[model samples]
Target: MLSTKEHADVFRELLRKGDRLYLVPVPGHSSALPEQLAAIAKNISADLELVETYADVFAALEVAVEGEKKRAIVLCGSLYLIGHFLSSINN
Candidate 1:
């Protein structure tokens, strides 16, 4: 539901506070953006994790939700990823 800028701002703020971020990558696609994000986080001294599967996504969300302090942001690469997440959530 958040715009990309809003998500980026949240990410920046989280990075500022030394929070861990997980960037879940869409399979079989270009990983340029995720890689760039990882590099940016590294530049700002933030921890970044790249996960690439449905199980990974579920696990990351479960951990973040259970942790209650940290947050996890899922960046869907294309319409396909967005649709998948949307459908899953709706169902």
Candidate 2:
């Protein structure tokens, strides 16, 4: 979806305002991956922007919620991002 201008714009808008923005990308791509998926794949852009580990992500969330009456952290992506997030915490 990031390859499409409309979808990409929507995604950008969704992350524009927040205490912190993190993008946890899938680690690697296979040849079986479609071209659009491959085009948007990278760890450095999403890679470097993401917290060093998922624990850092949760820690960021705890800090983020400190000032708000109501707040939530929205995590998006496939099982990959969630798996990465969970595995980091489990380890």
Candidate 3:
């Protein structure tokens, strides 16, 4: 899952073994950086791989999909991020 700090905890709840949780920064907004979010998640003993902070969702997805098997990706958080993803695909 990819999310910002506002919904990080909720997204963390949906984590499963083998899942990767990606926390990203919300540009222009005062929120926890992705690194900080990862730290917080680790503090709580969140399972799964906590990859490094990615500033771009597409970049994150690219890395996430690099394996052999098919995968399911969930993009959650602000509507702006969702819209950004949608716009990116439509381009």
TM-score of each: 0.46, 0.37, 0.71
Q: Write the per-residue lDDT of candidate 2 for residues 1-91, one digit (tens) a residue.
A: 2122343444444543332443333444221222333233322135323232222345545655667676566765445546766888799
lDDT of 1 by residue, 1-91 (tens): 1123344444455654545555555434443355455555566654444322223345546755664664545454355557656677899
Misplaced by over 4 Å in model 2 are: 1-21, 29-69
Highest lDDT, which number?
A: 3
Between prediction 1 and prediction 3, the one with superior lDDT is 3
Superposed by TM-score, candidate 1 places the C-alpha of residue 34 at a distance from the truth, in angstroms, of: 5.5
Worst 10 residues of 3 by lDDT: 1-10
lDDT of 3 by residue, 2-72 (tens): 34344446545765665677777654455466786667666554566655679878887787778837677
Quote model 2's TM-score.
0.37
Pairwise TM-score winner, candidates 1 and 3: 3
Highest-scoring model, TM-score: 3
- Model 1 TM-score, 2 decimals: 0.46
- Candidate order by decreasing lDDT: 3, 1, 2
User: Which regions in candidate 1 have their CA more than 4 angstroms from the true location?
Assistant: 1-14, 33-39, 46-55, 69-80
